[model samples]
Target: MNEIRVFCPATIANISCGFDVLGVALDSVGDEMVVRKIPEKGIRITKLEGQDLPKETERNVAGVAGLTLLEASGYDGGFEIEIYKKIKAGSGIGSSAASSSGAVWAMNELLGRPFSKIDLVRFAMEGERLASAVAHADNVAPALYGGFTLVRSYDPLDVVSIPNPPELYATVIHPQIEVKTSDSRSVLRTKITLAQGIKQWGNVGGLIAGLFTNDYDLIGRSLEDHIVEPIRSILIPGFDNVKSEALNAGALGCGISGSGPSIFAFCKGETIAKKVSESMKEVYQDIGIDHDVHVSKINTNGVRAI
Candidate 1:
């Protein structure tokens, strides 16, 4: 395909229990991108909409990611990209990831699928690094692998796809505040106590097992974040109230999504997910903070062509 249009997905990373490791993609929310193979030698950003960001190939995340892929492929020609952003930047939900993943994915598709998903993920990280100063794969992995993914090891770049429970749903509330990934990441402590580490490990294991076994209660119990939430929760307003209300509304559990500002909750069914959304919406409304709420079934197919 010389020109391909694709639906790139938004992602919730760090999933409360698996800081810097776990992520899931949303089925209905994301960005749209069109990539065209050209006779030129380098990547170019032909269009960008819905967000105020740089258009330069080197400065833009998508452009950077596409360039990374091109550099590795030794392809004779380059690509032209158009990005239509639906996910807001600094919204704590994989804004940069959609563009980055979309670009590299489309590029790989046009080249007869020479690169693996893991390879595409590595290329996407270059864009993320430009956006957040960290080449982490939590968001990109799920954006490409779909549903839930765990960054098992970074040294060898191992990413494991976790089965999504059929009834599992996610509700996310994004207050009108912006929390840049770089800014949110700065507040994190470099070290954690042994007790904290053990708790985090067990919860991560529990979450993975819960999904595998379709145990909603175990999933709920495993949603605890003993390490990152304490330090980062202060960054978002109404976080405590939202989490409490979500739990009260019968949500499985609730906690910060990604870095901050957007909070996500897990529910067993769509009805509870919608109910949890309202509970979360009410908190921001009561706080007089403008917000957006979304309820989505987990996306099993990450990115796809239109």
Candidate 2:
């Protein structure tokens, strides 16, 4: 069979408040998967790259995703998978999701396409389950549809593509630290007050509305998250100072991305985005931690073959 290749972009979910719900695709970073049929029966991952990546199916996130798709699609064949890892795993950068989503997408194409993007998303969650023990749709949604997305309810099977706001930039900072998703979730309070829940949902609604209308002010105003951010920020080193620096550099809004250790700051244009990125980098430098910053736009094309 001809080789099938797929690419999935990195995503930052929650954006400070919309925990487990909102996420946006980044234009410049992601991972790739290649799949092809072999005459054998079991799965064989021929190659794996990147830091701390595992090759065994039980440990390889992409391998698990491909096997899950094969089982769901009722295709019985030996498959050779090669994962080109670009996104670093465990930086709260949706690395596992990209691998899973890319594997599912590549295998679907190789099998003459059996699953829809929505169906593949559910299948991809198997990989996340292997890693994070929860079915997260944030990375999967953006990896499938591109642009901004809202996973309103995972169990109820709801996913929507949030409209892209114009003149927006996402400045991402990844510090050299590893915070597992399980640990991150454990840090969150199981029960939040009614007032806090209201505020969180209010920001969510406002973020949605702002995206639809391209209102930067509303988006900025809505980006504030008093609940999850406060609890999760403690996991990352120099989190508060970095956030303050990003905002002080003229960011429209700034907050922790997904779990922690990676911060995303939104700005109105490239100039402010660059400034915010520089400011974030400076904070990490001051803290004596190695970091990387990217001033990127929202990726509108989600995942596609290269």
Candidate 3:
């Protein structure tokens, strides 16, 4: 095939306790892109929709990811990419990962699928690094592979898909605010106390076990983040009120999605998910903060032809 179109779902990174090591895909919102082969021998971005973004191929996440794949696969031909972004940038919801993964996914189809899923993630991380200056795979891995993902290690780039409970639902609320990823990372402390570290590791272990054993209560109890959330939540308006309201509204757990301005909650069913969404929205509305809410099942399929 000389051309292909793909849709990549938005992802929630740092799922409360994971903090740069865990993520899950959300089915409701994402970005779409089309990649077509061209006569020129380089990657080019031909169109962009939804919001104004940088068009330079090297500067844009999609272009950087596509170029990385083309160079790695030794493809000499050029390709043009068109992006229709649905996920808002700086919303703490893997917006760049959707574009990056979607671009490489379409390019892979056009190139007859030369790269593996892991390689696609590696290439996508280049795009993420261009945007965030961090090569973490919590967002990219889940965006590329779908469902819940665990970045086991970054030294050798080990990523594995964790089992997902079928009945679990997600409610994501994106407030009308911008929180730059760089600033978010900058505000984080570089080290943690031994006591906090032990607690975090135990919670991480419990979360993994909860996913494996399908224990909803364990998952709820393990969704505590004592490190990143305490610092970053201060940046998001009404964060504490919204999280408390979500839990009171039947959400299992709630926390900041990725960095800030967007908050997500985990619920057991669609009805409760909707209720949690409304409760969270009420908090934002009462504060005069414009926001968008999405209630969805976890996306099992990540980037795919559409």
Candidate maximizing lDDT: 1
Clash list (residue pairs), candidate 1:
none
- Taking the tens digit of each residue's C-alpha lDDT, what string does model 1 give over 1-306? 799999998899999889989999998789999999999899989999999999999999999999999999999999999999999888888999999999999999999999999999999999999988889899999999899999999999999999978999999889998787777888998988999999999999999999999999999999999899988999898899999999999999888888878999999999999999998998888889999888998989898998
Q: Model 3, clash count?
A: 0
Rank by lDDT, highest first: 1, 3, 2
What TM-score does prediction 3 earn? Answer: 0.98
Over all chains combined, what TM-score does candidate 2 have? 0.96
What is the per-residue lDDT of model 3 for residues 1-306, given as tens digits with 9 covering 90 to 100?
Answer: 888888889999999889989999989889888889997898888999997899999999999988889899888788999999999888889999999989888888887888899999999999999988876788899999999999989889899999878889999999998888888889999999999988899999998999888788899999999999999998898999999999999998999999877999999889999999999999988999899999989998899888
lDDT of 2 at 13: 84
Residue 132's lDDT in candidate 1: 87
Per-residue lDDT value at 303 in model 2: 76
Can you list the residue pairs that collide in candidate 2?
none
Worst 10 residues of 2 by lDDT: 42-51
Q: What overall lDDT, based on C-alpha atoms, would model 2 receive against the true structure?
A: 0.85
For residues 279-303, could you state the per-residue lDDT of candidate 2 as single tens digits?
A: 9999889889999888888888887
Every model's TM-score:
0.98, 0.96, 0.98
